[model samples]
Target: MIGVMREGGLLVLTLQRPDKANALSKAMLSDLLAALDDPPQVLILTGEGRVFSAGADLEEAKAGLATDPIWDQLSNRIATLPSLTIAALNGTLAGGAMGMALACDLRLAVPGAKFFYPVMRLGYLPQPADPARLVALIGPARAKLILMAGAKIEAEEALAWGLIDRIVVPEDLLTTARALGADVLAAIPGHASAIKRLIG
Candidate 1:
């Protein structure tokens, strides 16, 4: 499920489903897209509990391959949001969910959170955007370390590798993200999106 709220001009979306580690489901993905239909000046993505997202729901994935396109669409939607977007990674980021975080303009995580890619282990090839963004963010070599070596990157290593922007304490993740969002909103209107397009 998705929990949506607005604090000033910032929209906060929490991935709710702690029992399943906030695994992404098809319905949940649709909800995300719908929520973005009328986006605010800034959007902050987080999770209700200790897991940002467990990626695509495995049970649904096993049922059929139809979910692939939906996930791709989800990633694309996040990547192309008109406003500044932030991923407040409160916990581990795994599988396809990594693509979601990468799509954001900035990613901030708790010190204990981790970055993981299990594509090779699961015999699943990443969609184009996932690896492409990873390569753009880090580089071919470090991207391989994650896609090929199946590395589990901690906060410090991820920051060193340029995988994540910052690591805040667990209790401060949302507040920090919101404050950053406020900064983005305070900028000249449309400046954030323009900068994102110019740089990216």
Candidate 2:
């Protein structure tokens, strides 16, 4: 359920299960995690449908996937990646998938995309490292609004709250992501990594 395309040092990973709203299955999560093993200089993650992810696959969630350690593992890997990671959100981001998107260095979403975690309503805890990252991006109160209060924030509110960096038209999403990464992709050997390290 992941499609990988690599060009030079740029890597793009797309969630491919559109019919399922890109709901992640165990195998799909594994594939996505595996894709990050050999870190690229610039990484962009986007989805192939109207929803980036509806979180865990329904059947898999019923089988305890909601609390799986792999979710934390995957998000952590993205969080610690030396390369610049961008979540080029093709659509709405929901549930557990919020971890991966929040972990990215920057987020660019389509105009109509919505952001919500809904874990409070679902009766499940978020991945271990997710809350801090979310809080860092949007502040504790705003993070609680989405996580504890189950607020469904749309693109504008998300941008203003700092949950997402920018909103781009669907057609320009990938183009904008690539443009944002151009400097990193063309940087001297360690320049991008050095800047990322300095930021943290």
Candidate 3:
């Protein structure tokens, strides 16, 4: 379930199924994909509970969800967005979920959040774009540490490694994300987006 909240020009997309560790079901993935089609100037992607996402829903994963092409499609769309996208990692980020976060413009995670993409251990490969993105934010060696070696990174280490931009307190996660997007929201219609394009 995806909970979309619009605040002025900012839209906060929350993964609403906490009972399942906010796992991404096929329906939830479809909802998220739909939500991104009309993104605001600043989009904040976060989760409702203590876990941003435990990756694909286990049941769905067993049924071939893990290798779905939609995963590649979703991550690619996020990467090409004109808006300033922020991933507000509310908690642990694992498995396939890393793709979306890796594609974001910036990542802010709570202090206790953990980051890992266990594709190696899971006996599956990450989406093609995902590995390239992961290497871009961090480095190829560090990317290998997680994707190849299955390393579980804590928020602090992730931040230091450039895997995440900031380590915010849980209570201030959304507020901080909103604040980070303030300038973008206030800028001329395409000013921020133009700057983002230049940076890329």
Candidate 4:
């Protein structure tokens, strides 16, 4: 399930299946796709409880690989959004979920958050774009360690490696994200978009 709400000009999307650690399901991905069609100046993606997302639902995955297309579409949409995007990581992130976070323009994570990519370990290959973005953020060597070696990166290390922009205390995660979003919104309207075009 997905939870959608607007805070001023910011759109906040929360993955709502805490029981399953907010794993991405077909319905949830569909909801996310629909929400991505039109977004405000700022968008924040996060999850309910403590987990941001555990990637695709393994239960559905065992049924077939039908979810691949939807996953790619969602990742592409977020990566190319015209608006500034943020991934407010509430907890551990893995697999396709890491791809989503990497697509964001900025990331703020809870101090306890950890990032890992288990694609290789699980006998799955990550989407090509995912690694491209990872390489762009942290460089090919570090990206290789994560994607090929399945390295577990803690929040502080992630920040040091430039994978995440900031580490926020649990209580202030959303508040800090909002403040950063507000700063984006308050900037000259077209400047941010133009900058995104030039750099991205």
Alpha-carbon RMSD to native, per candidate:
1.5, 0.7, 0.8, 1.5
Residues 80-148, candidate 4: write the lDDT tens digits: 887889999999897787877888999999987889888888888887678889999999999989999
Candidate 4: give the clashing pairs.
Answer: none
Collision pairs in model 1: none
Candidate 1: which stretches are off by over 4 Å? Answer: 65-67
Clashing pairs in 3: none
How would you encode candidate 3's per-residue C-alpha lDDT over 1-200 as one tens digit per residue? 78989878898999999999999998988888898888689989999989999999999999999989988888888888889999999999999999999989999999889998999988999988898999888899999999999999999999899999999999999999999999999998998889999999
Overall lDDT per candidate, in order of appearance:
0.85, 0.93, 0.92, 0.86
Winner by TM-score: 2
Give the lDDT of residue 121 in candidate 4: 84
C-alpha lDDT of candidate 1 relative to the true structure: 0.85
**What TM-score would each prediction reach against the true structure?**
0.94, 0.98, 0.98, 0.94
Model 4: residues with Cα > 4 Å off, grouped in runs = 65-67, 187-189
